[model samples]
Target chain A: MTADTVQSGLAAQGYVASPDLAMALHLALSLGRPLLLEGAAGVGKTEVARALAAWKRCDLIRLQCYEGLDAAQAIYEWNYPRQLLAIRAQGDHADEAKLFSETYLLERPLLRAIRQPIAPVLLIDEIDRADEEFEAYLLEILSDFAITIPELGTLRATTRPMVILTANGTRDLSDALRRRCLYAHVDYPDAGTELQILTTRHPTLNHHLAAQVVGFVQSLRKEELEKKPGVAEMLDFAAALAGLGVADLSADPAILQAALATLLKTQSDRAIITTEVAQRLAGKAA
Target chain B: MRGAVTRFAARDPGPAARIAGFMGHLRANGFRLGIAETETALAALATTDCSEPATRRALKSVCCGSAEDWARFDAVFDSFWRNGGRVRTKAVPSNTTPAKATREAEGQATSGAGRTDASDSQKDGEADTGGEGRLIATRVANLRRRDLREVVSADDIRLAETVARRLGAALRDRRSRRVKAAAKGARIDLRRTLRASLSTGGEPFRLKRRRRPDRPVRIAALVDVSGSMQPYARPFLAFLAGLMRADAAADAYLFHTRLVRVTEALRDEDPFRALNRISLLADGFGGGSRIGAALQHFATTHARTHVDGRTVVMILSDGYDSAPGTDIGTALGRLSKRGCRILWLNPLKGWRDYAPVASGMAAALPHLDLFAPAATLDDLAALETELARL
Candidate 1:
């Protein structure tokens, strides 16, 4: 599909993707390459895969990466307990080839995505948290859309799934992995986009409150807090204000400071944005 | 689209030459574009609507490999495409000297060896001629090998920081407790093997084994910013920033008469800006050296949480103590009891006739696992190989 089509498709799915991001996705689809998305913690990198899957009307398979992730957990595993029961039931007639066949094979996210009849969206989240050696295992599947097992030889994809890998800059990925994928960097949405997102997500909310909420969150990000509130946090803050029936941000100082639990994550962050700072930000937010 | 694809094909020499020239310009500006990336960009350009902005965005996705490269893509694109394939000298300072840009581009391809040769040639050229060009080249070469105390130029400091960053990214991995499946391992994985025995009729036919995986080593550096170490503190802080970038778990602290953790400040994406923030944070700099009290403060406050057996505690100081009766040996002994390795990087050791006869250095010498000199960038580069052995 063209970039414009991709943009419209994602917009229908409520993902408001930038033109550059849409273009990157279109190139990745046309060229049959994996896309790598890097950004801050909560800039909606993972949401892109979900939106793409919804737009494509296909399955969304997720593989969350962490330290010491290995191929057995990511690609496939054998159902050993069932194999043993079959061997016991068969007694001397158990065949080795049948035991290791597809019937006894358990498919993980990677294998399940490749084996799908229609192309699915595969999301590898927080890839930087995995060890460097784990990246070497991904090279074969990413470039060739295939996985090699010693017992099963090689399994190629019936339909090559769309792959999206997200990293939060915890560590540097190897150059080989970076070279194999199309790249995009996602940043926080601006004030206009944030307001659009809020109104879209909560359609019944008042427009004036939505503008004030988005304004306050945007201004609060400029403060010297340890963790700046993200888009998701902004949405949560807005929901809390609506639930509390607070129309104006500067009207209730004590309630605004208490509602910061949805925005501020750490104790230090809460201490930084005191009542005075919140009121000042609310005054400017008007 | 078919006509556009045909026009951009190799058979048509005009667009092909332009694309190659653009790729060359990108490479000169430190974008790593190999043949695969070039082919992808060309294919993307041919199939899509050929608007200039769309083409630039498509090529940017294909070419950029990191955040830094992504940030630099637009400027490089404007310089080459908007300027009619002529890279403006004002936009890119590296392109001002064609020879230097070409040399750096070549150096990028061969990695480390080509850069060493480039620096060596500069030194050799300086020995032959007394011209202004040769003099500047000589100064650039000397900056890498000169003592940090003698370094004064901003350009030299920037170059040294870049080298320090590269060196820090080469940190070696250490074996961790987490295990992965292996053919032969130190211990048997009973859980996996038991599960595997189902195919064999409850018989343990094949044994499953596991071995420890490798993770990046934890590092905590405490730099002395006292009066005596004023000259070397900036360069050492640059090195510390590199380590923090390489491993996110790494911690950094600065101390004079008191200790202040600057890990959050040094975590800024810009190294120069992080150094400036750190300089403002450490208002106690240029005070009298209090190595003993600083060590005591770290051991009492932060050692329990940050230091473990896998950690390497690096103390960058000259080991000169202004507090006479303070106890340094006991403080080091407490850290050593935690099973962490302590390393001392003394800039004073670079002197030809320097000795560790100072009371503080003599008391702490026996507690150190490694004592190395860090007077120049070359010495810091050498420490990479030394750290690998650890």
Candidate 2:
């Protein structure tokens, strides 16, 4: 599909992707390569995968990476309990080969994504968090869409899944992994995009309030605070304001401070964005 | 006349030739675009409707690898394509030969450093008298091996920081408390074994095993920022910042007469900003060296929570303590007993005839697990392998 098609598709899925991002995603799909999305936390890198999955009408299989993520956890594992049960049931006539068969195989996200009859969106979320060794294991699967199991030989993908890897820059990802994938740097949305996103997500909300909310968040991001309010946080803030039946941001100072609980994640962030700062942002937002 | 005619023809080259020239320009700007990336970009261009903006975006996705690359792509792209395929004198000077530009680019790319600013190179160009390109190449090579104390230029400091960051990335984590699946391990993985037993009708045929997980190394660095260490402190702090980036559990403290925890300050993504924050926090930075008192303070107050058996306590100091007779050994002994590895990195240790003549150095030397030189970027880089072994 064209970049415009991808952009429109994402927009339909309520993800207002930037032109650059849409281009990156389109190129990734066209080339049939993994797309590596790197950005700060709360920038909605994971949301892109969900949006793509929704757009494609495919299953979103996510493999959440952590420090010790290994092959057994990510790819596949043999059901040892099932194998033992079968052996016991067979009563010394148990076949060794049957134990490692597909019936006893527990398919993890990676394997399950590949083994799907229809191509799915495989989201390897926060890949930088995973160990360097774990990344080495991913090289084969990423490049060739195949996994090598000593027992089963090599199991290639029936339908090549669209792979999307997101990293929060915790550690420098290996150059090998970077080379194999198309790259996109997903920053926080701009004012216009944020307004579009806010209105798209919350259509029933008053247009004036939505604009103010977007404007306030944009200004708040410009503030020197840890963990600037992301789109998700802005949406939450909007929801909170709507739930509270607040009209103007500048009108309810106490309520604005209270509603900031949805936006400000850290104690320092909350402290930094005080009632005065919120009101000031709201005043400018008008 | 033939060479001139070829140059004239090359000025109005084909699309493929233009792309090849663009890739070369990208390479000169440290874009790490190999044949594979070039092919990907070409394939992207072929498949898509090649509008200028669309082509730029498409090529960017294929060509740019890291965040640094993504940031630099537009400038490089615009300079190559928009500027009529002529290499900007600012980027690759008109004066510099292609061979020299390629060598400099290779040096910059392989160093894990970001692109040298055009202005910085212009300054370098202005400074050099004879064999300018060779001098630039030699300078890049020399920066790594040069003493941090002798490193005066801001450019050298930036390069040092980049090398330090790579060194930090190389620092491997030791075995952790968490267990991972293993072929043969001391601990029995009951969860996996029981899960596996399901196929064999309630009979445990396979005993699943697990070993301790390999987690990132926890570093607790106590850097001396005293008056005596003024020349070395900045570079060492940069190294400490690298360690902090590599290991989330890493803690940094600046020590002079008093000990101040700069871990929070150093967590800032921008190294310069982190250093700026640290400068503000380090109240008595240029005071007399009091290694013993600082160690005592750390051991008594901070070590209990921050230091564990797996922690690597890295002390970057010359060991010229103002309080020589005070209890450095006692504090180090306490940390050592807790099973933490204490590494004493003295900048002065790089001297050929260097001895632990200083009373503080002599006193603390016996307590150290590893006492090595931290005089240069190369010396710091060597610690990666040393740390991995530890």
Give DockQ per model, in order.
0.42, 0.40
Error of 1 at B261 (Å): 21
Candidate with maximal DockQ: 1
Summarize candidate 2's per-residue lDDT along B1-390 as a digit string, tens digits: 333212335457677766787788776555566888877888889877878789999989988887657765775676555433342423333342343335434543433432222222212111111122224333432122211221123344466556656655565554676778976799999999998776556578889999986666567889997767866755686677666665566788877766767775667665544554465344444556678877876885567556777677889999888666447877787668667888999999988999988888887878888899987667888777876666
Q: Which fraction of the native contacts appears in each prediction?
A: 0.57, 0.71
lDDT of 1 by residue, A143-192 (tens): 88888877888999999989999997766687899999999988788999
What are the TM-scores, per candidate, against the unseen true structure?
0.66, 0.65
- In angstroms and one decimal each, the interface RMSD of every candidate reads 3.9, 4.5
lDDT of 1 by residue, B158-276 (tens): 65556655544554465776888776798899998988776666788889999996655578899887667866755676577666665677788887666767776667675544554
What TM-score number comes out for model 1?
Answer: 0.66
Badly placed stretches (over 4 Å) of model 1 are B1-13, B84-184, B189-202, B205-390
After best superposition, candidate 2 residue B107: deviation in angstroms?
A: 21
What class would a CAPRI assessor give candidate 1's docking?
Answer: acceptable
Candidate 2 positional error at B270, Å: 27
Model 1 gets an lDDT of 0.75
